[model samples]
Target: MCAKNILWIMCDQLRFDYLSCAGHPYLQTPNIDALANRGVRFSRAYVQSPICGPSRMSFYTGRYVRSHGSTWNGVPLRVGEPTLGDHLSEIGVRTALIGKTHMRADTEGMARLGIDPESLIGVQVAQCGFEPYERDDGLHPDGPYAPDPAYDDYLRDRGFGGSNPWEQWANSAQGEDGDILSGWLLAHADKPARVPEAHSETAYMTNRAMAFIREAKADGRPWCAHLSYIKPHWPYIVPAPYHDMYGANQVVPVVRSGREKENPHPLYASYMEERFSRVFARPGVRERVIPAYMGLIRQIDDHVGRLAAFLEEEGLTDSTMIVFTSDHGDYLGDHWLGEKELFHEVSVKIPLIVVDPSRDADATRGTVTDALVEAIDLAPTFLDAFGGKAKPHVLEGRSLLPLLRGSPDWTRRAVISEYDYSQRRARVDHDVPVADCRMTMVFDGRWKLVHVEGMRPMLYDLESDPEEFVDLGDDPACEAERARLLGLMFAWARNPANRITMSEEQIAAAYDTELDANILIGYWDEAEVDAARKARGDAE
Candidate 1:
């Protein structure tokens, strides 16, 4: 009744609607679609944060960004925060990382506690509690950012010689004049990457995952392989064949309008004026960039087919749970935005397909649910699949196993996401203080409200404006709805997120035993104390 292994596959910046199963008009992801046909696909899954580091930290820790305090990129997850690896490993599962987690070590926290970084406990804390088969964040530019030595060695061994082979060979493209074109420039997006298809980053990560699986099988240990891929993200140039698989004609319609910019929210207008947004809003930017983005996704699908086939060949398919998701979705010019920093559907919503091979999951196979799921839910789901109960005081997310097994009692009223933009240019442009550069979005099934610090809250009636074109933030007509959502946000913010040391049951038990411990402050007489003891069956 429990899965012997878990294969957690997470892609970088993949949108919810990009797969064939998810209603993409032109792009086809047959392998991912097949996975969906074999399991449950959540149609409305949102991450706790839209940014990479905070969102991934939420996914790893099963807690909100505010609770984890890793609110932005390069911010370290505090040393003692329990992650997926930490929880799974406690139950005798080997947790291994094959690729990116975007986790920085809280070295200061460790040093303050006098924990040696080279020690076993410190190593686990530094690596986000996963044994690194290979930990590569996948961005290996020259100069300040050092290339991943292992990936660089792999590239060089394959005869791609350069100071930074990952940047020069894997991410760059050859121009018409045979000049090396950096993938950093959006102009070269339509061209194929200089590296061969097999030597690409996606392929390398896939091979590493398979290698880890094979080793785990030989060792005969139940393992959770976090096969995280770093593609379909930036530097969006795929290898040949895949590069030109989709033309400019295949690109979906841009989901923005001039009306959105007419009287945008102050924060939204500031984001629209940012360089990336302005560049994406240009005449032919999306046409050039989106096809390559689609191509990268197609390549990932192909690799997924390869991985699934490998699992079956190794006789692990029937015992392993395959989970496919992403850190967050990309904006790609939606709402005049180039990146994922806002509360738009295109940015916060991500693809989540779970292929549980257990017999209990068969009834829900090939079904799509409109359940309100969050990124934090995955950690508890994995633990639940392994017959482990989620620690309610520690994990904020409920397990998805009941939903997977067709339990009817599963119900959720709202989902919440947070954003901290203190380090962003918008904060500086608006002259906002660091403490005031935060936003919280609370969405019921029909209405979405964003509470921005030091500003008017943004509201959208998704039932009326599914595209979120109209801002009802300052509209007096929607005052009642806005107030209701504000109340919900306030209640959510008031939750006791830090009360992790004791569960409600434990607290209740402690209260019940307080009088038994003879600390009776309200006792007026000895007869009353005797009656209380007799009632509690503690009379002597």
Candidate 2:
């Protein structure tokens, strides 16, 4: 039989709890719900890192950020790293990327990191293995302000002028919302530009992906396509039909009473709550934002629905495998944060679903598995499906096919996530440079240990405190368990060698410099030096 077509859909900055299938009542994710009903849902799948680049690096390389070295947004993915696309393409599968590929930021860090000035107009695409057909060069949320130059002239008419542009705009009543005149006009209920354009971001992405699928199908070859959507990432703006999905009152807020003293990260105490509160503060904002987010989700769900419908219509549904997940998650008023990269449940835990259409009735379908899976496992899983062996070069992930087959011994006790030194540095004051520090997290089924800054570590008993507002790291009683977790962490760090061999480009760029130093100082260099000296003495 021909290899099955693979479709991987990645939603940017999406919280796991926002799905109706995930028990979110206010969010309407009917398409996702339907997908879940037809497949298996991983209830405890977590991203390897909470940030965009690291998590995506984990996804494509099947290695943790520390091992892959694409830890920060600006850093490139070592060009030669064996990616899902590289492997799949090698085995007769055409791979295509569409929309919001944040995996690597080349060319002055513009295309992948969303930092280019042209990005303001939405035209920035084409990095991270994608070829874009249409790109939205101007879709920011704090947008869509009045277009009439007379409006500003009216402000001038009303005797409102200041020293600076923002100061002039924020003249007591007006604000610094990012929306310009064209965007503002579009935001109006009765505007022509509000109509969905053939080149709007979502529509363009969906259209191109469909075209790619059709072409690949016609070529009679298997294909792997990554349809990544930039919705709901930030500047939280959704187009119409999505804009009015819910009432503000109906949007549920993350519930946390008094702040706890457990987490010592500066962001935990100072910034998190304020961000959440700000989003919730605006009148009807929740209703506006939640439904917008849901609508955007539904929009993607619509794409998924269309793709699925096409598969079935073309007699390919049963011959394709569909995997849906996200790169980390958004704050969306949960814990009062907005964008992700935090260690909170809403930020780190993502929705992971896998549908194997060729599975037997007895195979795991519509099942919710609790195995501690991480994004790194995805590459190996895809490779496994294509009759490829997962080479062990620096790949710390395991295949899920055995788990899917219900092998009794197939179990992963823990999954690990490591933050880059740069992001951890962002958490503290400049005076306390965290460059020398590395954080490693290990979570078993019920317990989590966070070793940060080489200081006293943190332990959370999720069974007791699901919110993770309390840290049990200081408890003397949990010492044995703590030691065991530490042992596991050290063992992972001490892994002699991993297999998924890298290309020369990847080896130089993605290899963790810091981790390599530790290994050289503590492991390989001493043995090599001794061998060299002994050879010299023997010659003498």
Q: Count clashing residue pairs per candidate.
A: 0, 22
lDDT of 2 by residue, 11-60 (tens): 88888887888998777777777778888888999998887767887887
Clashing pairs in 1: none
Write down the lDDT of every candidate, Cα atoms only. Answer: 0.91, 0.64
- Candidate 2 lDDT at 347 equals 78
Model 1: residue 418 alpha-carbon error in angstroms? 0.5
User: What TM-score does each of the candidates earn?
Assistant: 0.96, 0.75
